[model samples]
Target: MRLIAFGESFVAGVGDPDHLGWVGRALAGRRAVTLYNLGVRGATSTKLASLWRREAEARLSDEEPCRIVFSFGVNDTWHAAGEARVTPAQSLLNARAMLTEAASLCPVLLVGPPPIPDAGRQARIEALNENFKLLCARLQVPFIDVFRPLAADGLWVCEAAAWDGAHPGAAGYQRMADLIAAHPLWRAFTLAE
Candidate 1:
């Protein structure tokens, strides 16, 4: 199996001391699979939607089994200079475009963005997560909600707070990975045929 994990820093495993962000930790021991981690530190949904297909296609072949895992939106909700980098409505559009096209190619999963410490930003992240979930359901795509659980999680909150007020450390990443790995859709998507 070939898996392409694309998105922002969380997907890249930024603050984890072990350097095996959720993707590396979650998919560990699956030797039959090769993972391409295409996480950019500050990518937004607009950038990801425009780029994932080209990047994923370069590393894939039609005859091979492959999958795409997209985890974004935290960056989209990022506000600087008195405005969000990308608005919530635009973020949903970007996600829909990516998921719709990716699913047409192969099985795919959408991992909702995790929460950060800022209350204002966290609120936007939560709303975006919910919107993404609804969009996924409408499209019949598999979506995993990481925001609410991690926001309420002590480890994830503290770790993210201490690190960069955004990304978490190893333990937090492990918990996030555990959550995803435990999801039934994730299991079915990754299981060997």
Candidate 2:
């Protein structure tokens, strides 16, 4: 099986000293799988949507089962000077188009963006996540909401807070790995054929 995961820093496993972000930990030890992590730091949905299909198509092998995982959104909520990098409406369009295209290719899973300590940015992230969840539901793609849970998790918050207030360390990544690993949809996706 080939799994192509697309996202930003969290998908890249940015602050983990171990270098194995949640993607590495969650999918570790799976057999007969080729995993590609296409996590570009500071990538927004527009950036990802523009490039993902071509990249993923090139990597997928017709001889094997394939899966796609999309986890991103936090970057779009970022502010520069005074403007949101990617507006909420633009984010929705990107999410719909990206998830729809990816789902057409294979079984797809959508993981919501994680939380940060900044109240303003966090609020944006939370709202984006809600919109993403609804979009995923409409598209029939499995969606995992990491924002609410991770926001309240002491370990996740402390690790991320003490660091860049965005990325977390190993233990925090491990918590995310656990959450993702335990999700029922994730199990079903991995278990399928």
Candidate 3:
């Protein structure tokens, strides 16, 4: 299996001491799966949409089964001088475009943005998460609501707070991986014959 995880720093595993991030931890015991982590720091959904096809194409082949996992939005909701980096409407458009393209190529999983320490930013993230859920439902794609679960998780909150207020450490990443692993869609996708 060939898998591509494309998104922002959270997907890149920024704050983790081991640097595996959630992607590495999630794919750890999956035998024979070649996974590529194309997560970039500070990337928005628009940036990802612009770059994903070209990047994914380079690593994927027609002869093999390939899958894509997308996790972003926190950066999109980021405020710089009282202005958002990417507005919710634009973010949804970018996500739709990327998911449409990716679904045409192979299976796609959408992981909603995780929580941050700031209430204001987290509010934006929560709204974005809801929008993402609606979008995924319309497209019949599998969506993972990482924000809701992680927002309430003490370990995730503590680890993220201890570091950058956005990214988390190894324990938090493990928690994320566990969540993804337990999702019914994830199980079915990985265990399919």
Q: In terms of lDDT, which candidate is strongest?
A: 2
Pairs clashing within candidate 3:
none
lDDT of 2 by residue, 1-193 (tens): 8989999999999999999899989887886778899999999999999999999999987898899999999999999999999999999999999988888899899999998888999899999999999999888889999888898887877898999988999999999999998888888877633
- lDDT of model 1, residue 6: 95
- The predictions' CA RMSDs to the true structure, in order, are 1.2, 1.2, 1.1
Give the alpha carbon lDDT tens digit for every residue of 63-160 in model 3: 87889899999999988998999999999999999999899999998999999888999899999999999999999999999888998887887888
Please list the residue runs of candidate 2 whose C-alpha ends up more than 4 Å from where it truly belongs after superposition. none
Candidate 2 lDDT trough over 10 residues, lowest sum: 184-193
Models sorted by lDDT, best on top: 2, 1, 3
Worst 10 residues of 3 by lDDT: 184-193
lDDT of 3 at 99: 91
Residue 175 miss distance in model 1 (angstroms): 0.6
